[model samples]
Target: MIFLAIATCSGSAFAYRPFDGTDAAVAEPGELEVELQPAGVQQEQGTRTLIAPWTVLNFGLSEEWEAVFEGRGETPLVPSGPTELMMGGAFLKHVVVPGSLQGKDGPSVATEFGVLLPDSTGDSGVGASWAGIVSQRWDWGTIHFNAETALTRDHHADVFVGTIIEGPSKWKVRPVAEFFYEKEFGLEETVSGLVGLIWQVSDKLSFDVAFRHALTNRHPVNEVRAGLTFAVPLRFEGAHNR
Candidate 1:
């Protein structure tokens, strides 16, 4: 049995749909980006977890910064549990050095820091986290690296390191893969892998699907996920004139 755990919201950043890590890119200023997972399922040790919906909202504050909010509702199917809201976070992402991720010449560098809020159950206290990101792009494909550390709700420390590989951006449908390892001090260590595809419907919309397998402290877990990402420009009086 393998049980892998990273900072909960950390793995849920969703830089590019269906993947766990994030890219070093911020939303365009005054633009809003939304990520939605209408339904997702996870199975572990004969127990099933269902996420009817998971959501993340990113608002571009400037060319170099973005604000992020994420939350989800989950239910245990096999054990028969009521649906409950869990894992909420608020973060700020900043671009330290713009590069390939921004259509420039080198790898882009960024960082995200924020507070992890308690769930609806109010069983845990507030926590905080920070993450670093680096991403590069090429005619062939794109790759991203992430490293994060968090002060967990239990007041323990957690660390996560991961990488994401993506197929050529020119393709309407691109292949994506993610590999990660994480450890929560005084708790457990985890290893996981995921493979998926993203369909670029247009410059502002995308759809994705992925499958993941993990070994979390010797417990085997499997998951299936699908989602969509879209961006909308914020309109204001004379906004376009700026």
Candidate 2:
């Protein structure tokens, strides 16, 4: 069995960008970023850990139009239960207002709508999820704020708000904080925060390190996460840019 700690973090290409609420629904044009986070802990019964990997790819349809595809998988290595795996559901994000941000040079308000495909474990059945994200840039840093909810056949819904604080540094390090509320899954709720450092090694390669801690004990897990992020430019020719 595998014992893994639970950690929550945002999956956006611009790690330095702050929470603007509208940015979560919009996809950047002609951008592809990959993020991988792995964490685990030892349990008294035995040992259990969680392995989660996710990737996001965005394509520019026009100057203001962009298409996005994202996929994520979670595998829990537990001693007694079956190996749980969840997969599928590709969503599309559209930028409602283009060139509304000062620093990121992207849309300020974006809308994201997608469907979650069923998985082998049956933990989350097939359903549709939708959310709105707003992103804005500040003199000190960039901010991204997002609210997401799930509309499924199983009558499940959740709301989440997060902020990313970008520091004044060459590597573009940012600290993140988030609060989550869920009506489904036995009225589970949590508040978590993470401190992360991002280094743009090159135009296409970057590394990220983060420590995550949960503020509420409502959930039976707490964890720290460390991972690397790589961005690959597609159909664009130039020096590696963030």
Model 2: per-residue lDDT, tens digit, 1-242? 11111111222212221121235433345665444444323232334555454434455555555554444344446654554444445566766665436245654876677666655455656666676667666555555666667655354564555555555334444444443333434455656565656666665565666555554434444444455655655555554552
RMSD of 2: 6.6
The alpha-carbon RMSD values of the candidates against the true structure, listed in the order shown, are 4.8, 6.6
Q: For candidate 1, lDDT tens digit of each residue in 1-242?
A: 00111122433433456777789998899898887788899998999998656777789999999998766677899999987766667889999999998878999999998888776665788888899999999999999999989887767898989999999999999999999998888998889999999999998999999999999997988999999999998867686688
Query: Native-vs-model 2 lDDT?
Result: 0.48
Best TM-score among the predictions, by candidate number:
1
Estimate the overall C-alpha local distance difference test score of candidate 1. Answer: 0.82
Model 2, residue 146: distance off in Å is 0.7
* Cα TM-score per model: 0.92, 0.69
Residue 2 of model 2, lDDT score = 12
